[model samples]
Target: MTVPGSAPTPPDPFAPARLGPLTLRNRVIKSATFEGVTPEGLVTDELIAYHRRPAAGGVGMTTVAYCAVSPEGRTERHQIWMRPEAVPGLRRLTDAVHREGAAVSAQIGHAGPVADARSNRLPALAPGRFLSPLGMRMTRAATAEDIARVIRAHAAAARIAVESGFDAVEMHFGHNYLASSFLSRRLNHRDDAYGGSLANRAEVALGIARAVRDEVGDTIAVTAKLNMDDGVPGGFWLDESLQVARRLQEEGTVDALELTAGSSLLNPMYLFRGEAPLSEFAAVFPRPMRLGIRLAGRRFLHAYPYEEAFLLPSARQFRAALSLPLILLGGITRRATVERAMAEGFEYVAMARALLREPDLVNRMAEDRDVRSLCIHCNKCMPTIYTGTHCPLVGPLAGPPAPPLTGDGGRPRPHAS
Candidate 1:
């Protein structure tokens, strides 16, 4: 009898590990699930509390999600964009997480076609013109000048992250964002140097990674969340993605690669395999958009069955193809899975929904080797991104919406901010 992909006694998942220049307490990282608490494109006390809970709960590192590289790169107006004005608040957030004894990383990227043009009041750029259902408009095809600007923006974002005291910066190259858009043959129809061939298409992602590394120079560990597959027919699939991963490994700019899947543009649910919360998602948008979602949500949010370590099979390909450190994401729910990832040679394991369901789960897992996560994979938390991201099955955020607190010594103030 043979244990599949078995190796020598696996390193303890709870042991300290080095990621580039920083030493993390353990091998587990809290994957970035866009915290919707930053309503003014700046940090809020709510945002700090959101990250603090997981750090205190015992993640080796807690990632602050979707810090856009520029104003126009944001998915919507409320998302945080890296800027000098944003640093002080980010500094406070980093400090809070540091007090919990966990390193913090900022996940930065340009949303591109994923950007909501109506809410951002700015044109969203894509590799080629495409109809954006979320913004109800056609995305503008990115120009050469626009590409240069976005590349510079990534470097600037990394500098800001360093100044704000982030221990790591995970460049977002997944989920059909700006760089990921260029990688897709189905989306990038341009005849320019930045399109057609895989190498040309990869120029954007490679350039951004090099620029970011040049700007920060190991001051903070640089990692990238890269798509292993886009999950759309004729999109960026494994064959091309393996080559892209090889190039990233060759460049040696990123310290580690966190492998992910799904297209935020065409197939958002592929990344998080489980029940698609269609009704909950529809409830968050305006009536017109809600109607659209009700009509078409199933097509976009196609459900995939839940399983333990869902991405491990694909991640194993990367592990086999490249020597760069790999973070296995998707369906990481229990201590056994983390151990499984380690046994298979993955450097770290990242979790989002599980930590959201029970913030103290890592600590609990440390105490009990057989511990399992409480997340039911219902994904009701998916729709909460528009309001405040929380698992509806647990804690204060659960149940019916509470009435807003009154101002003026508990008397209802007619015009409260």
Candidate 2:
């Protein structure tokens, strides 16, 4: 039944694949979902155990989530920020994952408008002055000095990643973080070199990426999580995002691009389809903010019906536009979906909630092609980032009983990636 001279099939999802200088054992990457175990901004035994399970189960790469370049860049004070003192702990984390035959990537970025300034005791930065609901204050607009410093911080973070034994560094340029905010026409209303035209707006992201690549050279693979769309009105759309993708390819700034959507600042639920846990979210905030959430949470946490490979439709656009390797994210939970992604030219697939639901999901799928994930997409896990990110249905896995549910939502922690 072979057709003569026909093109060969794409590589199997479970087979090895090259990413920059590193060859991952498979094409599945555990996308960065902020692990809430770090209470002191350093790696803890819990955090190590959190990633170790997924690595031991089966994933090409397990990403350490939202490691800020600077303390203020963190979404919450307890989040990890690259520092000399942190290297040893990070080394231990990387070693544990590597021992399981999986590569580990550190996701680095500034939270920008997403930062809970109140908790961090530092002002959040944005392209323009804007209101930060979490902090209940206005964000500070970035100056030229702040911009330069942030770009340099990204390079420094990559250097730390190399020292810490991370095989790859995923620069966070999506989710309405500092760089992403600059890319948004609605969020960025500035008249400087870092704003205005799309080219100008992209300077922050481009500078950081190039700096990271230059800092690490070929010592570590460089990847970016980019937004194909911001999923908000008057925001960065697919058309403009493709242009940015082309520029990144033209400059060879990244080895691969992981396409994602949704703005953590405006619409967090757009990226994660299913029920929005409004009550759980409101429980985590202060009473006044809790009231505010009851009034406006629905607008921010809009729900979309769950479906396998929900992001594929938009990701297909990027796949057609560039020859650069692309990682398709969002709603990837089945082996068939992985096959579909590879068959359609995507070099890799990234999963978050499904893996949180079952760290061994990938290994299970590898054993049986007919296997489907157990994640129901309830979104209950969304609020657990404060205590520990885990499926509430499996209470024991998340670590530490999240204190008795008080009338004010059981002592909520700060919001983060």
For residues 216-262, what per-residue lDDT tens digits would candidate 2 score against the true structure? 98898999999988889999999989999998899888999999998
What lDDT tens digits, residue by residue, belong to model 1 across residues 240-318? Answer: 9999999988989999999999988888888888998889877755566588778987987899999888888888988
**Which residue runs does candidate 2 get wrong by more than 4 Å?**
1-5, 286-291, 398-416
- List the global CA lDDT of all models: 0.86, 0.88
- Alpha-carbon error at 68 in model 1, in Å? 0.6
TM-score between model 1 and native: 0.93
Please name the candidate that would achieve the greatest lDDT relative to the true structure: 2
Q: Clashes in each model (backbone N, CA, C under 3 Å)?
A: 0, 0
